[model samples]
Target: MKKALRWISKNLIKIYAFLGFTYLFIPIIYTFVFSFNKYVRSNLVWKSFTLENWKNPCKPIDICSALGNSIKIGLLATAGATLLGTLIAFALARYAFKGRGFVNTLIFLPMATPELVLGASLLTMFLNLGFNPGFWTIVIAHVMFCISFVVVTVKARIASLDPRLEQAAMDLYANEHETFRRVTLPLVAPGIAGGALLAFSLSFDDFIITNFNSGTTMTFPLYVYTHEKGGLPAQANVIGFSMFFLALLIVIAGQIVGRKRKVSA
Candidate 1:
């Protein structure tokens, strides 16, 4: 008993990490496994395995349309948020302006506020402005929340940037625009990319805010939630798993590129 206790104590952190990873990945594993299940209506129970679901992920009713809407909104929101947030980050990092602290505090409000509250507030604001909820509304709502995260991410990167690099560029006869376009932008590109990716993911995965503003329009999350009683289609699982794998591949590729850059440098 004492030996077992001692061994467990020594290996506690490893055991905890293993369990944590297992818990996090269990849903992903379940989704992947169920993606291959042969089901006519409900995919709750495991049937014979088949690759048809993978072959036709869009076979399910309206799933593809919903996915397309999500993709469109994600892209638009990511673009808007990343552009605006990167500017804000640069401004906050580089300049001292009136009410800068107030602006900085406001940026965190959306992130700190609960989704339910934020969504409701947005809905109310839209209604007051005589605007109808739909695709644009969803995109607007997503961009609003996503901007906070993007700003936080890019700001951290800006804060970490070395001033000497820009100074050196200026010393070499590079003008402000030339230095920013050539050196500053490239140095900050990774953070901007990271922020854009994060914003896209958040917009895609969002349900509460989308639901509040979606009106008759449906997104993937909405479709999944609405179909929960009838059991989600195998195609849904296939699409879900495919997205997960795609994101995983992108991360792996990014890591490889980073390693190569490091070696070359």
Candidate 2:
């Protein structure tokens, strides 16, 4: 008993990590496994394995279109949120301006607020403004909530930046614009990229806000939710697994590129 207890104590952390990862990945593994299921209508039960689902991921009606809409909204929202948030982050980090504290507080409101409340409020605002709920509305709603996360991410990066680098550039006779373009932008690029990626993921995964604002237009999440009464199609699982793999590949590629840069530097 003593030997067993000691062994367990020594390996507790490893065991915990293994269990944690297993718990997190179980659903993802299930999704990947079910993607190969040969189901006529419902993918609830695994009948037989087949490659047809992956071969024709877009075979299901409107699934690909829904994915395309999500991609479009994610891109637009990420672009808008990253641009605005990066500027806000820089301003907050670099300058002391009137009402800066107020602005900073406001930035956190959307993030702190519940998605249901935020979505409903946005819906009300859009209706009051005589705007129709559709693709642009979804994009706008995503950007609004995603900005807080982007600002928080980029602002931390901006705060960590060494002012001495900028000072050194100035000492070397580099003008303000030139220094910013050459040195500051490069230093800040990683943070901006991280923020953009985060924003895109959040926008793509969003369902509540999209549902509240999207009247007729359908996104991937909405499609999945709407079809839940009917067993989820194998195509949905295929798309989900493909997206997961694509995201994993992107993260791996980014890590490789970052390591190369560090080694070269």
Candidate 3:
């Protein structure tokens, strides 16, 4: 009985982890498999295996356009959010200033707020400011929410860095600008990359907030949600699979680069 309990204790975590991954990946697996299915109108059921969907991902109406819009918004938002948030993170981490705590708290509030409320609030603000809801509005909203996440992520990375590195550079007669460019930026690059990736993912997948801010701009998630009434085409599944694989490839490439850098170092 004692051996049985010990074995169970040792294997329980592994079992749980396996289950967790399986649950998370089941939908993705289904989407990938169905991408190759030949369906007339809807991808509800797998009819037969065919490469047409993969060959022509733009076969579905507006799928390509929506995806393009999503990509555009995601890239723009990620760029803006990462730049702004990295500066804020650096300020909070490197310098002491009055009302710093208040600013930090304000940054945290955006992350803590519910998406629905945030969306509505943004909509109201845009209306009050006479800013029409459209592609730019969606981008603005994405940047607003994504900035908090970026700041949180980059701030943690900045905090984790050793101050001695900068001091050493200074001792060697390097100016503040040179030390930051040569020492600080390189060390914190991974964090910025991670934050940008996260921001892009969030912006790309956003439905609720985008729906609120986007007047007529159709993003990928909004397109998927709206087109579900007619059942999404197999090409939609193809797009999903493509995005999954693209993200996976990026992650794998990043890992490989990191490994190479470590080896060289």
Candidate 4:
């Protein structure tokens, strides 16, 4: 009994970790497997596997259009949010000015606010301003929320940087602009890239805010939501798997590049 108790206690954490990983990966596995499903209008069961689904990933016309919209909006929103947020982060981390505290507090408010509330409020404001909720409105809404996350992420990176690096650059007769361009920008670039990736992912995966702001615009998530009732097609799963693989490749490439740079240094 004592030996059995010891074994159980030793392996308990490993057991829990295995179960947790299993829980997370089951859906991903299901999606990847079903992407090869042979079906029409429903993919709830395994109806044999074929390469046709992968070949005809855009079989449904609307799905491709929705994916395009999602990609467009995500890219635009990420660019806008990353640029604005990087500026804000630099200001908060490097400057002391009037209303600094207030600005810092205000930036966090959007992140704290619920998505539903933010969406509804944005929708209401657009209506009041006589602006139609479409591509631009969705982009605006995504940027508004994404900027907060970007600011927080980049600000942390900025805050952790050593000011002595900039001081050394200036001591070498480099002006402020030159120092920022050569030294500061390079050092903080990883953080900016991380924040932009995060912003893009958040914008792409968002459903609630997009639903509220995307009037007559069908995003990938919205399409999935609507079609799930009728059973999602294998093409949808193909898109999901494709996105996962794309992201995986990007990450792997970044890691390889980082390793090479480190070895060269």
Candidate 5:
């Protein structure tokens, strides 16, 4: 009876997994399908299909501009956050420091808070300091959320590192800076790269914080939200489907590179 019940539980977990996957993917599939729709309604029927939306000509000019800004903000924020987070992680994971717990807690607090609350609080603080919520504000807000992820990822990487390398380097009369550059860094570089890529992905996809701090800024996600609220647009589906294709391509490219590396090894 116990074995039978265990078997039933395993089958039930598989069923639940399928249901969850379906729930997640159905909307994305629908969005991709309707990207080619002739009509812009929320629902897509068999009769509607067109490529005009994807191959569109534009006059409003905001989409292109917003795309540029989003890329800019993502790159800048990712770069800044990755650099700062890596430094902090190295310090924390390599050395015993005063107020380490307090500092770590403070560092992680932004990530734990709701995006809406973070955005609102930052907006208020920036406004109080006579800075407006706009492009740079959005970048800063993105950095706040993104940095914690980097710190956590890189800290784990550093924590897992062999301290013997540093000890050996010191025995060879290498300075702390030299040891860090030569020994500590190369070992953790892959993890840091992975973390930064992840941070870029998160910053790029963010909508809630972007929306609150954007002011006049129109990121792709914000653009989608705006058009979605106004009424559905064929162009929205086209953008979404494009993102899906881009994500798929990235996944495939990573797999190919990974396989090639394995073959090389």
Candidate 6:
């Protein structure tokens, strides 16, 4: 009876695991299906599949332009945020100074602020300064949020690292810059990269802040929101699936590279 009970427990656990996986992936599956549905109307009618959204030229070109702009903004914002974040992390993790706690809290204020609040504040500031809300303004707003994430991730990594490694390198006759270049940078690179990826994804996926500050610009998410009043779109489904697969591929590649480096070491 005990063995039977154990067997039942194992089977129930497997069933629950399968259910969780299905729950997680159902949206992806539905999104793919809806992308191919011939029924553009949101009616519950189940019907034949169509690929018109992907191949049709009559469809809005704003999506293509938005994709380009989003990638460009993601790159720029990621670079700006990562560089500033790295510096701030190094300062906080490696140095002691007056008002350290206050400074750290200030750095987090932007991150903790709600997106709507941040966007509204930025909009007000830009108007007050007579600055037109444009691509650069949007990028700056995004960087404000992205930098905090980078700082937290990198600071945690730096805190976990032993300082002795750099001291040992210095003792072996390496200059301060050389020691950092050879030892410290490489060691903290993963966290930096992970943070950069997070930054890029955040910039790419941003909608509320982008909408408030985009002015004449249109990002992918903004475009989606603007056009959503018509109905949930088939093209949107396609884009959603594509992004999911692309991000998944990049994550898998990063893991493989990290593992290879670990094995080589």
Question: 173 in model 3: Cα distance from truth in Å?
Answer: 1.5
Best TM-score among the predictions, by candidate number:
2
The TM-score values for the models, in the order shown, are 0.92, 0.95, 0.94, 0.92, 0.83, 0.89
CA lDDT of each candidate?
0.93, 0.94, 0.93, 0.93, 0.82, 0.87
Better of 2 and 4 by TM-score: 2
Q: What is the C-alpha RMSD of each candidate to the true structure, in Å?
A: 2.1, 1.6, 2.0, 2.3, 3.6, 2.6
**Number of residue pairs clashing in candidate 2, backbone atoms closer than 3 angstroms, sequence gap of 3 or more or interchain:** 0
Model 3, span 1-265: residue lDDT tens: 9999999899999989999999999999999998888887878887998999888889777889999999999999999999999999999998999998899899999988999999999999999999899999999999999999999899999999999999999999999999999999999999999899999999999999999999999999999999888888888888888898999998999899999989999
Model 1 spans > 4 angstroms off = 1-12
Q: Residues 188-244, candidate 2, lDDT per residue (tens digit)?
A: 889999999999999999999999999899999999999988878899999988998
**TM match of model 6 to true structure:** 0.89
After superposition, the stretches of candidate 2 with alpha carbons farther than 4 Å from their true spots are 1-8
**For model 3, what is the error of residue 150's alpha carbon versus the real structure, in angstroms, after optimal superposition?**
0.4
Worst 10 residues of 5 by lDDT: 57-66
Candidate 2 — what's its lDDT? Answer: 0.94
Candidate 4 per-residue lDDT over residues 159-208, each given as its tens digit: 88999999999999999999999999999998999999999999999999
